[model samples]
Target: MAQWIRGWGQRGWAAPAGVCLCLFLLLTACGQSAPTGEKCLNCHEGIEEISAAHPMESFACVTCHGGNPQATEAEAAHAGMRGGRNPSDLAVLDAACNCHNGLAETGQDHIHRVRTSLQTTYAGAIAQVAFAFGAQPDPTARYGMLAVTDDNITTATGQPALELFRPGPDDSPMLHRFADNCLFCHVGGEPLAQPYFYRSTGCAACHMVYDNDGLYKGGDPTIDPAEPGHAREHRFTTAIPFTQCNHCHNRGNYSLAQMEFLPRPDLPDDRPLTDLERRELEYYQPIAQFTLCEWKLDCIDCHTNGEVMGDGDIHSSKLEVQYNQCQTCHGTPDALPLLTTIDSVDHPAIRSANLNPNYEVRVGDTVIATTRGETFGWVLWDGQRLWLTKKVDGMVYEVPLALGTACQQKPDEQASQYCHECHAYQRTVAPLP
Candidate 1:
């Protein structure tokens, strides 16, 4: 005790005291040992589905979100919180995402990818508009040729590079319209109107799901409410459902399936839709007659993280992104490898599939190790039966793929086109009663 006092005295009393105070604040901020039992945790303890990487004991609420961890009162505790409820906002990304600095192999380094993504920047919109006005050579040309350094004014293309693309001043009217109306859905733009659609730009766009009715109760946190609603759960999970993706994918004019241009005279607002009307609104032309897997499975079931989040490469269009075809899973006509034996497993593909927890191995099974030495034991199939699992909810399904039955498609010759040939509603008929 005497030696400790002497050490402090040598370093100057005030400086030593300040150091001790900083250390105490850091410990408290991380929720190591809070005198009042971690005020944030007191309210949020009910939400047990936080990411496995971020445990409550080691990573406190205040560490990523700036707030007064010492404050006992609600208002005071949330006073200086950055990005409000969304930590994935670019403003707070540096502080919140420092942990992912070295996790490129696991695809945790998503901050840089989102910043440069065509979906976030609307680079495709810019390129198309520029090409329409003869400013660029091709509509399919890359955004890099335009030389867009910031949010506004591309330097190399679109009439006068220095000024804003507006009607009165600029030569390109189409480019001006794109800049005015079409540019707001990107990363830094305003939040969506629906509370359930409240996803932050960059990382949170895909990972988080804000249940407004259950969590916010009355209003969204991104928009100020008359009376602030209690946030029920911070649902951050890799197992994203198709409904969560419907807001952007289904409601937009530019859909991946080109369904926006299709004729839909059935939907007249102000009345609840009938079953047929709902079906028409939901599915596109050929997609309406797709197999059960198309309707039952989540988007992430087929499209892995590297395809969606990106492989640290800037793509001009969604088509350019890497994805799995039907052949990748079901196999070619000549060969169909059943994932029963350890030697038969497609190790690289299986390792890639296991990136998300939804496709992870079941709790207790024979662990199949990848070539990179990561082990996974969840068996999706044996030699005889296919043990398929749904990604949205952990529901296991076993189906027989034998020949000379109602299912005419042979297991050995299963392809996407082959499955669609017989499984489509138009081709299928009811069994004789």
Candidate 2:
């Protein structure tokens, strides 16, 4: 026994049950893990680059859409994909903002301004509805769909913060109905499943255009034709047309008393509308009075980026930020419109113009500016006449400046409603059945 002990040592106890189980699981997972042999394009055939600027040759889809790009099958590959086939949705906006940092110093925060914009937050609408329904004491904006904050204050009307609104037990009954119906119109909110209401949420709601049909009309053969919620193409555009805006606005009227949305009775469902017919309907309501130029210019041509999108602040109402007026182009009958020169390559207007395909803003160009110094990049002053290049079609119009014209408008009192008293167009609408 003494000689055997000297020759060999005794063995220790076996591993614990947990350790043994972990080892087995590790080996099994290694064997059963998803295959990484194929790439995203192997299955998603016929898919083109998102746009001319974002060619797939350089920019990878995985960069914006988080997905298992190495996976061979659908579920595993699309498991973490942002916005579920929509990379630009607010749900996945953090990833989308990464691509928008190349414009300028302020450009890095472009998405922040949009996130806080009245369109996304719908703070003004919420405030109005809340006040009308007695959910709040006054019409001041106190809440939004999601809570948002602005660290930087740019304007006097910008709200520093907004609280997330939810229906409480003590809330008025009408708020419930409003919460159900009215919330669908915001930029990030999912549009109702209706013909004219079909649009992607967030930035895609505009940039990624959708036709009335809401079906895939792109070159991607893999996309299902039966699906009814895809963009018209896998592309982005800044030269947005009035039709794009029509998908959200001018679709219908909402009754606060009834708490219901009534589709436009004038809108014919059976057939498409002619260009003039569509323009007449889209300009405003049937009873609305507006000038001819209101229809001639697309919504984006007049509404500045800060006006349409938020300017890093939450507003109480759309009118609070809607400063664009008739005299922005037409003079005050006393002086020429506000003029400024583009002198820097890195100007915000240059970056803004570059996003679109229609026109360019170059150095030494004299363009009109707002009273507050924001440049109107499209309008050019040649010291004689102002020429405006249309964002939608690139057609130039010789803007008649009121240097010597008989326009007796008080320069400060030149809002659209005021001008309508003089130049309100009377066009015939399609007769109702």
Candidate 3:
């Protein structure tokens, strides 16, 4: 200022040491400090609550991760580490979400709709293995109703298109047996094992969670190269919990009802087992019946991140990305439609149920919140009955909405699938002897 201290005092430097080196390089380029004193918060200062919405005093761990924040040494500050610690790696999520301008922004681009999800392009298991190998006549082959441009695959009735359906070597042998046995659960695939089934692929396979008892370990530095006491938790969240959507909705044979689990074997080698034989050795064992809001809600408590991340619609199933059912939170006997309109009250579901200290915000009520925020009201009576309460177990309940009585055998007008077809339950039962 003053012509940059008179051109640094005519290049000789000494107008009070070039105005204290131009006020310490303008306060280290306005980020106040750490010009290269190598600060990944000096060994991750309690991981600032895991990217608490991106703030290392304004996104500093080398700006969405590129190494050498001036290299104070973890191998030269992780030497050029671009997306090594999974910056939601779809080959590094367009350069680690180039700060929101490139995840694609329609209803805020959940990693480009989980990178074009149909459970990450299994596209109905590659259109039912290309219609059982006749290379597609029907299994309704849908890459969300295809229209590829280069290498030209086309079909919304302009037919004749297949684009050598995936898994190379000139594809098809049932798409290389559905990409060598049904391509590992998408995103970027591979990475699912216990330790509450670790996940990581684009968007940290549902907003990250990795630990080894540092409980909720955020700022993941990835030490679980096979459990070096598992670390990874820079806590990105959406209040996701349903045990992180049961690590892929409770696995196998299209799980959560086609249900299958085996585990019970290892104890015989020495017979030392007993904590009720290792808690009756792991068994999910079920074949059907599963709703009581899947044991009282938390699949994002009725799936809304614009119905499981994609309001920019490219859905081809998970039942077209499930837009809530059972009358979207139990409302149909007749008149209950007020999902917030009393001045919308700063609606993020009514300001998270008005900061729920056991919610109360009444104004001709119609609440439902939950995903662990828990709100519930629903009231209405005589416009034709409906009743619930549950602001954290204040439990009022009585929403059975009439089925032909006599233990409701079949009239079903979808009142939460007729109260889950006589209320579902089974985690383990059968000891009445």
Top model by lDDT, which number? 2
What tens digits encode model 2's per-residue C-alpha lDDT throughout 1-433?
0011111011112323433354344334323222334387887677766764554654456766768878877889988888888778876787654544222245556677777778888888889888987888988888988888877777888788989978788888888888887788888888877666688887788888887778888778778877887778888888788878888887887888878888787764454778777677656677688777777778888889878876667788887888878788876789888889998876777767766566667779899898766788887787777777777766666776666877777767777888888888886766456
Q: Give the Cα error of residue 216 in candidate 1, in Å.
A: 3.3
Instruction: Name the regions of candidate 2 deviating beyond 4 angstroms.
Output: 1-38, 101-105, 268-273
- The RMSD of every model to the true structure, in order and in angstroms, is 14.4, 19.3, 25.7
Clashes of 3: 5
Per-candidate TM equals: 0.63, 0.87, 0.28
Instruction: lDDT winner between 2 and 3, please give it.
Output: 2
lDDT of 3 by residue, 1-433 (tens): 0011111112121122333454454344434443345566666666544443453554556655678886566888878777686666766766656433232322234555555555555465666656666665877645422232212122122222223245546555555555555456565666545444467666767777544122444454433334432335666654445545445555444322222233222212334555433223222334545554444434554455545554333444455555455555554445243343233433344333332233233445555443233233323233444444333322334455432333533334554556566666554433222
Q: Rate the local accuracy (lDDT) of all candidates.
A: 0.48, 0.73, 0.46
Provide backbone clash counts, one per model. Answer: 1, 1, 5
TM-score of 3: 0.28
